[model samples]
Target chain A: MRMKRLACCLAIAAFTLPATASAQGLLENPADLIWVSVSAALVFFMQAGFALLEGGFVRTKNTVNVIMKNYADLCVGVLAFWALGFGLMFGDNPSGWIGVTHFVPGDLTGGEAGFMVFQMMFAATAATIVSGAVAERMRFAAYAIGAVAVTGVIYPVYGSWVWGSAFEGSGWLSERGFIDFAGSTVVHSIGGWCALAAAIVLGPRLGRFGPKGEVRNIPGHSLPSVALGVFILWLGWFGFNGGSTLAADASIGKVLLNTNLAAAAGVVGTMILLTALRRPVLITSSVNGALAGLVAITAGCGSMEPVFAVLTGFIAAPIAVFGGDLLLKLRVDDVVGAIPVHGFCGAWGTLAAGLFLDEGLFQPGVITTQLLGIGAAFLWAFPLAWLCFAGINVVLKVRAESIHEQRGLDFTEHSEVGYPEFQTDLPHAGRND
Target chain B: MAAHDNARYSRERAVISEVLGSKLDAAGVQSALDLWDRKFAGQKSVPLIEFVNEIEAVQALEARERHELRLALYKGMIQAAAGPTTTAARATTRATSPTRPRVEFKGTPAEIVFLKIVQYYGEQLRVLGPAVMQQFLSELRAALEERRMPGMLGDAMATVAMRGAVPDGVQWGNTARMHMLAQGLYVAACKAAGPVQADRILLGAVNQAKQLEAAKVFAPSQFL
Candidate 1:
């Protein structure tokens, strides 16, 4: 399946050539297309990891619901991105803040399509993360609406400002030169913020708090699933970070190395802190912290040096650990620490881009540019998200199940149970009541 | 209930006793374990937080240097809220009622009609939560008696409110905008129900709250 995907993507890359050689100057090289295609595939696979991660975190009753949502997110993202979602996000009609673009290129080329595929994976990724964070009790239909809004509208529109909305130009697109080389602010933060809004509107899962409002530790049902999910996510990060390099150059190897190095250090850092604090090592924190490092290194993966990557990632772990608690303090119930791992750390990553980017990374004012990019993404995302979610929350019955029912999202939302019945169906016997 | 699902269970700080274990003051490990314990307890109250204030004590002892003192108390309470209750110094006048009333917006008395009725309805059910639990409760008792047949209220309310939190497509479809307003009453009703013994009370309360809130928002003044 992987080989076929790669071959098909390569075939697409070969087809963007124009009759005139000079016009080709404006287009991307085929290798970059290959790089993007592979990365997109990796990020796409993270959806599976997300499914298991969420399913395990929730109770046994809600496993199927979480898995189903992850599946639906991919469907929504593909359709939305292919349809008007892509056009609205990347179109050239920039009015200083927002704009739209059509999928059809006046004269179509396959290389550009590869970038579309790559970006599509990213859009899908952002969309999927929300499902896991807001899992278990949310109405499948209402949650689907939120997912559609994310891939179709939120992810794409914000994405267009930095990358090309429909077809990225050399200079301007989206809101005109919004500087996200890779989408730390654009992708991770968007997912994080949306998770924040949804969890808020939905309220805490039942029994998460006691009568006095003290939090109760809710343990996941599966250890292997959580561990495997983390490892899977860690493996996927190579594509998420390295593929952002856009080509198979030695520079990309640096991005990959730095990404791996950061994640490794993040694991060590979290473990050391956890142990020193004399706390048993928390798998959730460890996973989230490592993911945090990966997310932190994403924006500046190629731009910064190894030392800076270490600093950026090293800073990310503690921030996420502390940030996770901040959500509890604020009474915002994030199921998997989504707000801390993505939202808070995403913001930190963007800001770190400002502080860490050097000659190895970019020009002197790169810090300022990174700031502008991060700030604008927030200014654009936060209010719109709050409004969109709050408005829907007010209008619709956002909570599909009560606190008791929420303990098992699958039972509340879907018909099937997460854990399969160990015993098969018994011989049929009918009794009339 | 039979099994503990704590993934990190039994992995507490290792006590290296006999080997250099006799008097190893591993403050680093001790503090880390304490933080973990506090996190698990869901009570931010960590012991020996005073060391954070005393620089000399912290500086003098490396192990307790990075000690984090979490003040888990809420507002004025210095101690935890859930321990066994001590006998009061005096008989208390105020009562924390478990069966607190579900709030509602009673049809404005004769002088208030139509627009005023709608305003009151909006106030009671427009998504912020039924104005106040006390008022909502009194009005609910009256409204249920008047509009609903006593025997059939629960199932009916459950079906309707279970329809969902928000209306689809059209914004605030069928006065659903007011649904958000009733959230508070629903909460108070549940909290008032005390520790849940049956799913019926919660389901019934949610349904009733939704029904009352919905009626205020969905119905015309004449219906009220």
Candidate 2:
């Protein structure tokens, strides 16, 4: 009787062990992985949108240089994220300041790649924002180094502080209930503030300011291209805001609708302001206004009602316009208004989430928590970006020479021009003759 | 001209035109002619700037009218330089006083409209003082170049400069020109070099006139 009972126990143990291990191997839901992967692809495509938008807004003489810098951001950013940024953002955190594990994805088929790729796109996006602010002047070598530093350290360190634990017990910000729904503080603001820092370090482009410190207009090369780029970004924003949900569920529809509504509200609000101010109802400003709305809404798209989303966007438009003016007033030469559209508006959106939290969903100290997050992000991003750019300048000279600037970065740096057929008179043509 | 030389000349001309839009007038024509003789006729580099202690316009002209004025001035200069006995040469030899009317009337509808508006605004023009006009012109020009409605300028000067509250019935497309004309007249009324940069005032007036021309106005009264 004893032998028979022992045999029965052994058989049951054998049956359960293999099944448990198999289940552990299939821990992630296939549908979720697929959704996240697709979202990553959508996010990746935004790099192209950024390239076109930035390239089009800059002078035609520097289009190739803009394209090259944007591409380098992704290239350098992705590799940096893969090697250290992902781990630093998601590793086990006893200190709640930085991640300490998962350097290169230990599990290939365990759905880690999906998460890594999505996050990598976001890291690349953050890195690229500085490209526009410093476009037409930054040296490629310095820009490459800066891209690596931003993606590798400056961006990820702050990211870990806010989103390190993924809603678990990973970081101090998360512990304090600091909410940044889709990284208004983490991604956009970091990029925006960094752009501000970079612009300050680089100074204004040639002919941007007068001897008396007067502001001058440097119009973009092509509105049609800018319009198209904006549309692409608008379309990709679904992935930007929607994919943040990290699921293929009903919530995506609401997030997407909120994103669209805010963008539209931004356009209307900006146009109204332009009409009131006696400025032309420029398509360029409108596009930027819409982006401001989108950036602002990104923080609270998931938490707030659609109405608040519209309000957030409506208010963001003016902030973008005025904030850009403020930067110029201070002599910071942000070429693409990224500081206003992303940095200022990003903070507004993050705080708005706290003020406009859904009825009865508000936590006791969430607003304070949001402010802390905003202050922290600003303090971290701006100073670090300033330091990074300053330090890089010491090594590689962050800004292109004045002669190179007059020649256009395309011809001076890349030995190419975007519109060579039409650009027959290179700056050096007279000297060459 | 060689093909490359032509391209350079056109590019420089375009830059000058874009930068000096709507500000081109009788005085501007004289200045351009002087500049052409001193610089372009000798194949010298365009210095990319024209200095004027103070320039003001009593009327807003259409961009087209200012463009035509510029084209005519350039053509005349080229003819005078290329042939010493042409009518253009004779015209070029005549002394041009800043206050003299250089733009002629061919009785085209656009020119008639431009002349009429200039005449109307001339009566209302007041010299606000050069400093005030200079600052105002700077604000207005920046606003125009940015294609934004002049919120800063409007807020700062609308009470003193505008003819009246912008009418509710005004078409959206015409709003910029209306504000521009009102501001131009204010600058003209307040003309006198105060604290404003002379060159900025002059360049500002020329650009304002060019903008007016684009909006379909003709010759505006030039203030210097």
Candidate 3:
């Protein structure tokens, strides 16, 4: 009788104490902590999605090399972000331009620590985006150095201007009410703009352009892998947008619904456009359309109504297709259409967030603030990334040698091949070597 | 002795059948096979060298087609001889038989080198497909006209079009002209198939030339 009574009292107290503590604001609700932590894990799993997508985008000969770069993005990105990026991004920022305190934080409250893990995944994602853009030809060491630059300085510093108030002071853009609910501009566009600069500096892969300046098609090796990767990313986006709420609240349901609707709309839009244009509905382009939709909806997923989310995603398909064509016209060889899917579409999504707000759609001041944030991302990321790439080129020769390229980076850099039995041109017997 | 002759005849006929099948359509292949049987009806065995010579004189085939057919015949005969044999036995058979014909190039060292290089490029272009080969020939004609070597262009076109079988009464050009022609072929291969393949093709040609007695003194790297 005594044991049963004590057990009953303990169960009652366990339930009541959390409610009291949460109400008093002394401790975080356990449900909120679990949600954010799970979401952080989902975001981290996106690194594997990136690896598969990039690996599928390149030739079989360079697949291993591309996967290695993705691994570099996660491993190097995590360390760099933990050491310098977190403090620079979330530290006290009275200047409204950059963070001023908290480098390599050891002591933190539970909520701050969870936020740090979530943000660390975002930084790693920003670094990994460049890997696909510079696939097949960029030197491995140069890419690792580039990852460090992105995670350590470029992404965090730019991130500070928008999301710097996690610990103490506010960001200039946030102060101006620039609405980026889930970092369409902060994470995706920053990464995309950095990708653009790196690609421009690195130049195109060998034989990408013909002698007559014609654009040749260098299709990726595996469409199935690309499709699987997009699906994984789509799954991860749920946590990405939902977890940004920082609590297990009623709003997560609507945010996730918006996200899924946009992705579906993106696929439909791409298929319809391709059929109307008399182009074959390519699986590769369709998956990319799905990614474009996901990227576009990310900024506005929380604030926009479901209908506008569909519109945002549907519009992003054409933007991605046309943006890819424009890059080809400009002689830019983006391997996996990273520039269109992330950079251009991200900017559009940022704008859509302001334009499609449920409260008051298209408020002039909100639109202007969003525009400033978009332009600031481009202005800040591209030039600095370009200079970094050029500097790496001058110092360490960022481009692989013609001999190494002919032999494939897998054999030359890592001394392994993805599909050895299928390959007839072993690295040893080639004349260029 | 009678059983050995029967086995040899079967091997020779099978080799000829396999070679002709790749080069001709169904009806044409059958017709060629019938002609082979008729020609070698009473013979104990058709020597591969003699059969190749007979193929060279076949009036129904184009010169390039005959050349391709002869190359295929030689490869098939070697494989047939080595079939189901131990490595040592295959090596002994190859050493003792007259099936392996040594190609004798009748030209100065540079001319021999030129012929070997052109032949190698032609073979590689054929492997890359007919469209690539046609494009290369078109490019070569334009390049030759730009260099104002119309007479040389005609000879070059004839030699390449005929799979490097030089026309009678033609002059073997100097090393410089050969180098220029070789470089043109390299460029065309690179444009069609990319540099990696072009380099491999050129290296194979150089190695082929190095094996020839007459062209052994010439530097292979210069052609590349």
Task: Specify the highest-DockQ model's number.
Answer: 3
Residues A203-231, candidate 3: write the lDDT tens digits. 88765665566676777789889989988
In the range A1-433, model 2's lDDT, one tens digit per residue, is 9878765654443333221111122217777778878878888888888888899889776899989999999999999988888767865544677765556554545565677788899999999999999987899989888889889988888888887843223778887877787878899999998888889989877656654667767777887888888888888788888888887789998889999999999999999999999999999899998899989999899988999999999999999999988988887888788899989999999988887788544555888899999999989989988999999999889889644654578877888788877764443321222
lDDT of 3 by residue, B1-224 (tens): 47655555556556665566454333334444566677854353446545644442232244565678778776765655545323213222211231212334457777777777777776676666545565566565555565566555444443443334555555657777766666666655655665556657866887777777766677554554
Give the CAPRI rating of model 3.
incorrect
lDDT per residue, candidate 2, B1-224, as tens digits?
Answer: 77655544544444333333334444443444445445553365323213222223321232343355456445543543343333422232323453433333234333333333443333222233334434444544454445455443333232223221222222323433543544343333322222122223333443444455333543332121
Error of 1 at A135 (Å): 1.6
The TM-score leader among the candidates is 3
Report the candidate with higher DockQ, 1 versus 3: 3
lDDT by residue for model 1 over A146-198, one digit each (tens)? 88888887876677566653333322333333344567788998888888878
Model 3 lDDT, residue A89, Cα: 83
- True-vs-predicted CA distance for residue B85, candidate 2, Å: 38
What DockQ, on C-alphas, does every prediction get?
0.03, 0.02, 0.05
The lDDT for every candidate, in the order shown, is 0.56, 0.68, 0.76
Provide the TM-score of chain A alone for each candidate, in the order shown: 0.85, 0.91, 0.92
Alpha-carbon RMSD of each model: 20.1, 20.1, 18.1
User: What docking grade does candidate 1 earn?
Assistant: incorrect
State the displacement of the C-alpha of residue A404, model 2, in Å, after optimal TM-score superposition: 0.6
